[model samples]
Target: MQNNEELKLALLIASIAMLMMAFFVISFVMYYQKKRFEEEKKISDIEKNYNRLLLDTALNSEETERRRIAQDLHDDIGTMLSLTKLSLNQLSKMIGTTGDEKEDQIMKKSQSLVEETILHVRRITRDLVPTTLERFGLLEAIEEFIDKLEEDNNLVISFQANTEEFPRQGQKLELTLYRIMQELVNNAIKHASCSRIEISLESTEEMIGLRVTDNGVGFDPEKIKENNLAGLGLLGIESRLAIVNGTVQYEKPLNGGSSAFAQIPVMPIAENKPEPLHPFRRERVNI
Candidate 1:
């Protein structure tokens, strides 16, 4: 009886020791996994910040170059063309039609060509750098752009804002939004084959939203992802929105067509603070 009792006690002690060992091993594994996960997340966050910095630098450089080119076109090429036109006018006046029909026609044609070239240069300059956007604000700039488009194309484009007196967001936010709008409109016109487009801009205390709806052939998001049918336009839109910490979504309206809505979180600018020169330099809000 004594031997049996001693054997039972030994077995129980051994079992308890094995359980304690198993518990320690599991605890160590779990702790190591948690630490490893935390390290990976830290590394990932660092990489994202680095990439964002690079993107901001690249975009800022591009905008600066664009502004430079626009200025040159306006100051140099545009001025030179105007002067040539003036000179032609003087030459025509001095000659006063010497009964040379061919020469008269040639002079008239030369003046017309110069005027046309000047108009083209002005249009290109406006496209490269939207002066109206800088001077007036986003709403006015967009209205002017849409009006011009309507005049030039057979399509009907309508724009509506939440208010007549839309408040100004900073220059960077405004420009980024303007560019995104331009891209959306261009894409709709080129790809959607829509006769009419409706664009609405809404601003609230927390966020600013833009919605573009068109009655045309819509697209499949999955197919676009698989086949890359979106081309660079979609990518450009994404990048611009990313810079502003905004998001865009596409939906197929039940009536037949597609709509794109983009939202950017708004941060109220301090009344006394000056707007930053670079739009990308503004504080970002994670969506």
Candidate 2:
């Protein structure tokens, strides 16, 4: 009877041990499940946010393009039509041309107007189709952009390509970079009020860096953020660089002025130019 009691007690203890073990296993499973649930939730949130940002960027890009097209049309075609109308009006006013007096004078004025309009139209069309970018490559295209800036703004610009060549990359990325540079330089002229602009492009085996500097009234980045939100020029640039897997950083010089630096990881190349591709059909730029 005593031995039976002892066995009963042993069995009870064993059962209790097993029950505790089972409880622990259940706890562990519940903990694991909860962790997995949290991880998946976080991932979902990230994906949703990413999609939202992409949509916003696309819409903004479209709006910007529409504005640019409007500009080209207004600057080029509108100018031509206005001059043509003026010419015709001048001719109409000079009615009753005796021999070659008024007719010659009116014709001369009209010819001059027509010539100016043609030149304007051709210029706008060429900007729409800068075949040089494909035929000449990035360096040459940059030089041309600089020359055009000088002519339009009367601003002195200096540029240097330290790598001697640009690497093979997605066309969109290249175009984005070109536009970024253009935007940066344009902003300096319009707002910075700087007399000189310096540009440098350097590359390493795994990365390329671009720096544009101007000795102008440098503003604090933190201050700018507090003052404005959407209208910030560099904000759009930051978004644009992200689309190309690149970065843009702002630097306030120790002495004076400001510098904008951008970098992208890329394999280095030494060719004088990239392989020719189809011409860059100028998308009507956003204003």
Candidate 3:
């Protein structure tokens, strides 16, 4: 009887030990999972904050650009037009019942000024938003932009479109994509000092790709992330891509230049979808 009691006690102790071991193993797993979740949450929060900052920067930059353009129109082109009108009004008062040679000369000069002002207004409007992109399509708009750039100087831009038609990514996507290319071209002109630029548009089953290659000194992606003075262009590109669910890759070739490749994923446009409300929409706010 004593032996049987001892045997039973030993078995019970062993079982209790196994049970404690199992409990500890489960507790450790739970703790590990909780820790992992916390870490992931922190990462997610960081991303959200970064994106928020990017959006704010983009919006502010856009507002500044718009204001500058508006001021140019009001102060420069608008002033010229107003002066032309004043000149015509003064000339009309000087006109007598008979034609004068001096009057004819003044009229011709005023007409020339009017023509010059019209051309300037058209150029400014085109720069603000290309009418070709809206009316004709992206391809034509790009070609026109490149032609204008080439006309200005040695900024030789070679453009090729692999597809005949652009993917149906909605108007907003089209405009955003155009703006991205526009910004890239301006950056290449102002900062890169690139003489030769090659642009290619390609479409795949998954996404649309835009590649701009410039024969100029390359830039460091790290410097862009660090927000250096020379990296504002890259920063703008980053902000644009973030908003559009796009990706950008920058590479430097052995020939000593930079290449920028941007890819935008194809998203299906929902039918009869309501327009998204802008979060920062306001009637007027004094800055």
Candidate 4:
């Protein structure tokens, strides 16, 4: 009887020990899973924040540099060029040679050089800051731009305006659209064999659409995809649209030409929450 009782006790002890071991193993596994999940989550959040900061900083820095360069050209270089032209005029008047063709030639050369300088400075300023876009909203500026492109590039640029006003898109979106149009027109002039190109804009309640069509010797999308990537002009347009949460499609239209279309978000983008305003925060540049 005593031996049987001891055997039963030992069996109970063994069972309890096994149960405790199982419980410990399960607890360890649960802990490891939780820790792994937390680690991954932390990594993901860090990457997301890093990307946001990088994009914002890049855009902001670009704007700052543009403003600075435009101001310098307009305020400093423009004034000097004008003053130099005036000085040349005064000198020509003082050195009055009685109808000397040689003097006239020198004066003409100076005048031409001065004109070129002024024109170049103006061009640089316009490129840096589209004063028209700021003053006359987007539609009028676009029309004016097309007119300039016609005179400057000698390319038959056609633009059809579907909307007279686009108030909801705000200045940022309008600027992007204007810049993209400028880029497309430039690309057409440089690469597209066709002289005529078409630009159209349509807007609905939900989104805005832009179409750029060229009657050029259209290249296959698959074969020339490498060229498109290498130039980065196409990639640049893609990136800009992406910032505004837009989509771009490249195709050949029924008229036997290449067409690129973009649709962008019209509604306001969601605002991100600012990082915690801690007392220890410093003017530390993010590397």
Best by lDDT: 1
lDDT of 2 by residue, 66-121 (tens): 44564566566767677777767666556535456757776777767766776676
What global local distance difference test value does model 4 have? 0.74
Give the Å error, residue 274, model 4: 20
**Cα misplacement distance, residue 118 of candidate 2 (Å):** 3.3
On TM-score, the stronger of 1 and 2 is 1
- What CA root-mean-square deviation does each model show from the true structure? 4.5, 6.2, 6.1, 7.1
Worst 10 residues of 2 by lDDT: 278-287
lDDT of 4 by residue, 162-271 (tens): 86665635555776787788787777777778778999988987788888889887655665675555366777677667667788788876777678888887866326
Candidate 3 residue lDDT tens string, 1-287: 99999999999999999999999999999999999999999999899878867685666466446545655675677777878777776776667445787887777777777867867776675676455765666788899999988987787899998988865555445556777898888887877888899999887878888898888877876666577654666777777677668898877777977888999887666565323222122322111
Candidate 1's C-alpha runs over 4 A off are: 1-20, 270-287
Per-model clash counts, in order, read: 0, 3, 0, 0
TM-score of 4: 0.75
Least lDDT summed over 10 consecutive residues: which range in candidate 3? 278-287
Model 3 misplaced stretches (Cα beyond 4 Å): 1-22, 31-115, 220-230, 270-287
List per-prediction Cα lDDT, in the order shown. Answer: 0.83, 0.69, 0.73, 0.74
Candidate ordering by lDDT (highest first): 1, 4, 3, 2
Judge candidate 4 at residue 165 and give its lDDT.
64
Predicted structure 3, TM vs. truth: 0.69
